[model samples]
Target: MSKMIFINLPVTDLDASTRFYKALGASRNPQFSNENAACMMLCDTIGVMILTHGYYRTFTSRTIADARATSQMLLALTVEARADVDRLVGAGVTAGGRADPNPPQDHGFMWSRSVEDPDGHVWEIFWMDPAAAAGDTTGVDA
Candidate 1:
């Protein structure tokens, strides 16, 4: 299958967003991250295009949601394992992000936690055991 790639988000402050994602271990794509937009590299194949509010608004007609007080999108990023979910959240906290108090979710096969960046973008870190997810297994990592 073709690899899934790219997500575009709106940021109020490009510089701040650049610094924020950097703290989460994502590098700014110099080629794209600039005065108008910034490309945050999530992986070799995956990236998030962050555009300034004005630039982002040009593509949509609806009013922009206040990222900190509201949410326009929910982004779930898969992690290597359960520990990775926590690790990412912890890293977010140290970098000025906030972990949602009531957002932990656990099902027999799927587990997730989330944190919000200063810009109020929600990042859901999740882990899914395919065998369990498919109902073929009962054992969960945790």
Candidate 2:
């Protein structure tokens, strides 16, 4: 069987977070959702578990850091094209998320945009042409 990845994130408001993710094209997995937690299916192999701050604390003894003030990690997802990256970012922003404070990246072969969800979770949406990214200097500057 293929390995599946589950990312757990603490959210200040479960309902709002659920809406934000749905706007980005993820669907809620009823099998794993509840009053205190929601399972957002990003795809067949990846799932994001959004837990209420109180419920999240049950898993760890440490205090939850305010994501707005500090970034613990950047969650990245690769899409088929640059447009797809932009689309997700647009959806996120429209749903009350904020774009990354940093400038977008464009390396000829790869393009990326970042956005912060309502709870301040950072997500990087990117796209890369495999051939161009593999050192194929055809039509690209070295």
Candidate 3:
């Protein structure tokens, strides 16, 4: 069986967060969702679990950092094409997210942009040429 990754996040508004993710192309998994939490599947093997602040605290004793005011962590998602990276960021902004919390990056071989969710979590969307990724920079510009 293939390994799966589930990133758990603390959200102020579960419903809003769920909707935001949905707009960004994630499907909600009803099997593991409820009022206190939601399971948003980014893909077949990757999921994002949106948990209410109260429920999230149950899992850890540490205080939850306010993502908007502090730098917690940066999450990144790689898509198949450069257009897909823009599409995801645009959708996120349309769904109430903040666009380009970080500057967009374009290095000929790779392209990336960032969007901040309603709860202030930033997600970097990127795409890289397969050839460049494989170390074949023969035709890459920079």
lDDT of each residue in 10-86, candidate 3, tens digit only = 99999899989998889999999999999999999999999999999999999999999998799999999899999
lDDT of 3 at 52: 99
Residue by residue across 1-142, what tens digits does model 1's lDDT show?
5586878788887877777677666888798766999888877887888888899999998887887777677888888777788888888888878897346998747779988876889988888886776767755654
Whole-model lDDT values for every prediction: 0.80, 0.90, 0.95
For candidate 3, which ten residues in a row score worst on lDDT?
Answer: 133-142
How would the candidate models be sorted by TM-score, starting from the highest? 3, 2, 1
Clashing pairs in 1: 33-38
| Local error of candidate 2 at residue 99 (angstroms) | 1.4
Worst 10 residues of 1 by lDDT: 133-142
lDDT of 2 at 63: 88
lDDT-best of 1 and 2: 2
For model 3, the superposed segments whose C-alpha errors exceed 4 Å read none
For candidate 3, give the lDDT.
Answer: 0.95
Q: What TM-score does prediction 2 earn?
A: 0.94
TM-score for candidate 3, residues paired by index: 0.96
